[model samples]
Every structure is written in C-alpha cells, then in structure tokens.
Target: MLSRTYSRRVDRVQAAVDALELPPAVYRTCPFEPRELVETGLRQWLRCCGAAMLDRQVIGMPSFAVDEAWHGLILCTERYAAFCRRAYGRFLHHHPQGGELAGSARRAGSMAEQLRRTAVAWSFVARPGEECVLWDLDVRVGVPEPWGAGTRP
Candidate 1:
C-alpha cells in the first residue's frame, strides 16, 4: 500500500499547478501516454513503416502535442506527476500505504537541477522544450481574505 502522507504530497503539488493561471500560448499537451514517451523513437518507427497521420494510418497517431494548455498543465507538474498519475489512475487521491517506492532519485535530482536553472519549466518536466511555473500552495493558503473582510483573525 502507499502512505497517506506521501500521497498527500502529490495532491498538494497538483493543487498548486491548478492555481498558477499560466498563459495559453506557452504550454500544450501531447496525445500520448506518459509511458509512451517515444518522441524520437516514434518518428523513426513511422519512417520504417512508411506511414503518416494525415490519413488515419496508425492506431494511435499523436493528434496533439503535450504543449497544449491542459497537457502543459500536466507536463508542468511532472515531479510528483508520474507517481500521482499512477496513484490516481482515474482520479486524484492519496496513495494506499504498503508498496515500496519505485523510480530513481536521479530523476528527482534532474528535476531539481532544472528547477534551479529555471523557475517556470523549472519545477517539472525537465525534458520539456517549454515550461511555466506552478503555484506554491505554502504561500497560497497564507494569503489574507478579501478586502471586504480585511483584518487578521
């Protein structure tokens, strides 16, 4: 099973991205599963088959790029994303507690390196050609109430 605390981390990260309000032009989504990250392989594979998407050739030809608004949203939070997606499957929730952690720290390390290098794409999806910032929940929840209800409790 997965630990509730570990799962909570993913939820928190997701909420932050939802709040960032990124511009529409800079991000997008690709029509492929995270597991199907064969960007270069797919291109080469297609050439061998002598097929294309214009005529509905392959069973799953990429119709769009992950650079799209919604896709970018998902791509932007790639840090906890792989874990989150696998955890939620159909929806977002805390992970069950039991299964041992998989994946390597090297991936997380790479993401950290990218984050230090950039603040926008800086957070997740290091391989991304383009990226934007996801909000920081730690700061979000601290924001004061509306002007009408101003003043600390």
Candidate 2:
C-alpha cells in the first residue's frame, strides 16, 4: 500500500496525464517473458488504444524498466511542460522560502535537459501483485517556451 502523501502525488500525476489526453501505454518486461513477447504486448496495447495512442515513433521506448516492480514515466511535450511549471509555481506559492525561485529555476533546467534526452521517461512505483502507482511523474517540454516561465499566475 502507498502512503497518503504518495497517493496524493499519484493523483496529481494522473490528473496531469489525463489532461494531456495521450492514450495510456503500459510497458513492462517480465523476467520470464521474452523480448519479442514484450514488444508484441506493447504493440497490442497501443492497438487497443487506437487513435488515442500517441504516435509510437514520437513516444519512443515506452518501457523504462525490466524486472523491477516500480517504474517511472516522463512524458515530454511543450504543453505538458508548461503545465508542470504552472503547477510547480502554485506549489511554491503555497509553500515559500528564500531562494526558492532560484532552486526551481535550476530544477527546471535539469528537467529540460532530461526532456531533450528522451521523448518520454518513467518514474513510478509498482509492487508485485499490486497495481503500479505513480510516485513522481516528470514532464519535459521539448522546446522551451517563454510562456509560464516565471512565478505562478
């Protein structure tokens, strides 16, 4: 079972993912499953999602882990990144401290770097025999836009 705080984080991430309207894709490679099987499974999943699925080519590798119960997924998109920035700014507003904006700027830079590195990355928790729960979902915007660059609105 996930802690309350973790659960809240998952809820927030899920809300963000939902807002993106990118069809969900489950990527997992079991120890017992062959690579071919994993690929086939992912393809099948995407097919099931139909038009809702984001272009596989654009999404790149959907699975970020193998044999691990927990996983992390980072969806990189300009809109999503803006959403994260707004969300983070709101968070900072509610909980403020000196030099917080500087720290946030540094983190934003790091996030941008990661976004440039991958189309989508995954970071979540999935315990065996239980549903996978998101612990941290990082959004990397492809191109840095001027909108939502500063503090919260």
Candidate 3:
C-alpha cells in the first residue's frame, strides 16, 4: 500500500502546502496464497513505490502495507491507474525479486524486511546520494464477515 501526498506552494504573497491521503497498496487485495511469500511481485511493488517518490508523481489515494509505513505513489494528471503501472514497472527493474526482498529475507547476509500484508503508502525526505528513504504505506483489509478496527495509524 502507498500514501501519496503533495504540498503545493501557493503564493500571492505567501506559500502553502496541501496534503492528500492516498489508497492502500496496489496489491493489498491480491491474495498471497500462503506460499511463504514470493519474490518477484513484492520486490516489484517496492521498486514502484520508490520510483513514485523519486518521480514526484504520487497524488490522492496512497496505498499501504502491513507495517503502516507509507509507500510513495505517483499521481498523473492523465489517470491514477496509469501511474501505478509506470511505478510498478520501474520497481521491477530496480529490485528484481528472488534476488532481494523475496530472496534475501530468508538469509542473514541481506537487508529489507519481509512484508506480510500488502496494503501500503509512502512519502520522501531529502537525503544524500541517489537514495531517498523508502516507505511502505498502510492499508486495512476489512474484517472477513463484518467488523474491524477503526484506529488511525
């Protein structure tokens, strides 16, 4: 899942910022099928979120993940879904699974947490080098038959 936010500087004589909450992770609703997790899909998802932050494309309706961190998603004036595809694709190339998130979690020589729930969102803060701090958004999966928690993260 991812959280997309934008602060626009509006000024006639001053500046202001606007923040919008995005949807849960793109793959949150997709079932993991209890296979100890897969590599390709999750890694691709993370890469997309990171790219969205770097690209500055995320907007309203950021997605989320199990841990409640916000993954950055880009917003395109053209359409939101289109943006998702672009971001996801970029992630696939940057951090291929079975090589990173999926493969490394089981080993000690690696980094990157293995995520359980997919609901997610994101945001970014400036830092040195080409890397911005990566975030995984938080999303809620409604209770199976009826009620669930209404707490805010």
Please, what is the TM-score per model? 0.22, 0.25, 0.21
TM-score winner between candidates 1 and 3:
1
- Is 2 or 3 the stronger prediction by TM-score? 2
lDDT of 3 by residue, 32-143 (tens): 3221122222333444344344443332212222112222222222333443344332221223234446544344232222221112222232222532112212213322
Q: Pick the candidate with the highest lDDT.
A: 1
Better lDDT candidate (2, 3): 2
Poorest stretch of ten by lDDT in candidate 3: 9-18
Segments in model 3 whose C-alpha atoms lie over 4 Å from true places: 1-48, 51-85, 88-102, 107-121, 125-141, 145-153
- Model 2, C-alpha of 135: deviation from truth (Å): 19
Stretches > 4 Å off in candidate 2: 22-77, 86-153
TM-score of 1: 0.22
**Model 2 lDDT per residue over 55-137, tens place:** 12111222322111112112224443454443222211111223345555444344334323222222232223532111111
Candidate 1 vs 2: which has more lDDT: 1
